[model samples]
Target: MKLPLHERIRSEIETAILSGTLRPGARLPTEHELMQRYDCSRMTVNKALSALAVAGLVDRNKRAGSSVAQPKVHSMVLDIPDLEQEVVRRGQRYRFQLSGREVKQPDPDYPEELQLAGNSDLLRLEGVHFADDRPLACERRLISLAAVPDIAAQMFDKISPGAWLLEHVPWTEAETRIAAVAADRTIAARLELPIGSACLSIERRTWRGADGITLVHQHFVGTAYDLVARFGPAKGSTGAEPQQL
Candidate 1:
């Protein structure tokens, strides 16, 4: 099936932005220029640009034209979810069972900086979060053994690593990223979803003082969870208010 003309235009620009061809702060083509390039009407070009602006991928300026948006630094200071507590609050039984654990020394193949593997061993863990005997999320976590040596000895029989870390460790800084993805064979099997099923992925990292503590990536069925981030603009930035749909 062929996409609409406006959709095709949007996809082209979107691919450029994601592929780093159109970098952040880079000026995009003018509305008139896009109309000429796509051989579409001004309304079609405007529609494509409007959609990109709504997705936080571009900043539109009527007089100066459009440009790629800078990445957001603030995450609204919202409460990060501990799946166990979240499930229980929903009046359901919460359980976390570890399926795999290993102490790994990460190489350059991975994002070494975030893994905190330069001088420390990373305790890699794979697990699933359950609610009332149903799979809720799949997790892959890496704990810096150097930052929290005690985590090496703690056997997570009845508690999850995330919950345990939250209780025992104090973080000075943290970051979170949310993305949509299609479930692959591994994630599909773990979440009991069909291949290509839409999924939501949350990746987070925390640091204690100057040292990195842990990094975790979790995947949830798209229909099973809602991530609401209600935040205003940062103190000095002219960015728009952010909301997750």
Candidate 2:
């Protein structure tokens, strides 16, 4: 099966944006120019750009033409089931570069950062996550060893810890906090990004059953990634506004 022409074109543009060749607010070529460049009809160019616009990659307007939108801060409130299904449907080859694992007591070095107690049984793991061969994210996770025993024997080489646990264990709930942060030296090196680059940091905790706290995951996202949501009213329309905090 081959990719549709328009999808291929859209992917090309997306790659350019991720690689920083198409900076924020940079105007994309006109339909005529794209037709010439891709050797396709106006319909093909229009379809390609339209798909990009729908995906929040570009802003297209009759008067303003088409240009890259400034990258948005993402808030992905994903239903876990849907995310798992989507990943399976994509049939993408995945890989993980396991950094290391440590057994230690928790610390309060970054209090504002996920606040785990200092005396808690901590098992820390670090790695770079990949989709196919592309570096997707730098992951640093801390698991409560007392909560999930035998975690040290589990190998994350063939599957992500998150996905693996989701399949093998039953989780009741998860809480997450997302924020923007600048990449540090270690992350920059791992993600092949420049130092001080903007990245999204997500902290999450998952609970198993009623009393078991399973894991804590921290994801550092690179450019071209976003968390999206479908918005609607919480109840009947009134003076209330959408709450984001």
Candidate 3:
């Protein structure tokens, strides 16, 4: 489906900001300039800018014009325990099955957030994580071969891609997005849930410096697990509460 004129304009600018073409505090084009460039009216341009401001992506001032907002960084520590260990800790037998693995080029449909260059092979893996022989999560991952060439030769039958990457690769940074989504036919079957069941979906991307390392999406049965993160001050620390993002 085609985006409305204002939304298309918003998306283009958002893409530039996300792709680092428009760095923090960089001034966006004047409203008149955007109007001319997008062949739209001033109202349309203002609407797009308004949406960006509401999204916390840009700062707008009547006299100073609009500029990209400084990206806020939050320190969130999540317990990404190994699935096998987690199940064992709960006194349940743990098992995993590597359902599929292949080396292939990323298709056009690949997410733009990964910022991968064209014409590079990616190692795709699909599997199911189980506890007490009951499926708990469905895993889909894409590993950049350019970043970790040795990954293509490893057989993942005995180890998960996430575990192997954590052991072998040194990542400088990671980002995660979490949401609740309804299970489709494929995910429902893999996680042994009814179709349209509520599931917790997590998309994580790890990076080594400026290079992309891996992107993985894991879907867990919502009723089977609860995602938890702890937040507090360090020992002997005198500081204000961390700012919300």
Residue lDDT tens for model 3, 1-245: 34579977876887687556888899999999999998999999999998778766789999999999875553333334466666676777767799998887777675642364334788888999877788888898888887677787888778778878867665545777889999999999998888999988988887644668888899988788766555543111112111111
In order, the Cα lDDT scores of the candidates are: 0.77, 0.62, 0.75
Q: Pick the candidate with the highest lDDT.
A: 1
Candidate 3 regions with alpha-carbon error over 4 angstroms: 1-79, 111-114, 117-119, 232-245
Q: Cα deviation of 192 in candidate 1 (Å)?
A: 0.7
Per-residue lDDT, model 3, residue 166, is 66
TM-score (C-alpha, index-matched) for candidate 2: 0.52
Candidate 1 runs further than 4 Å off: 1-76, 113-115, 230-245
Tens digit per residue, CA lDDT, model 2, 93-188:
457778888776766575522344223567778887665566657777776655455565787777666666655444434666778888889877
Q: Rank the candidates by TM-score, best first.
A: 1, 3, 2
- Please, what are the lDDT tens digits per residue for candidate 1 over residues 107-176? 5677854457548788999999887777788999999988777888878989999999867665535777
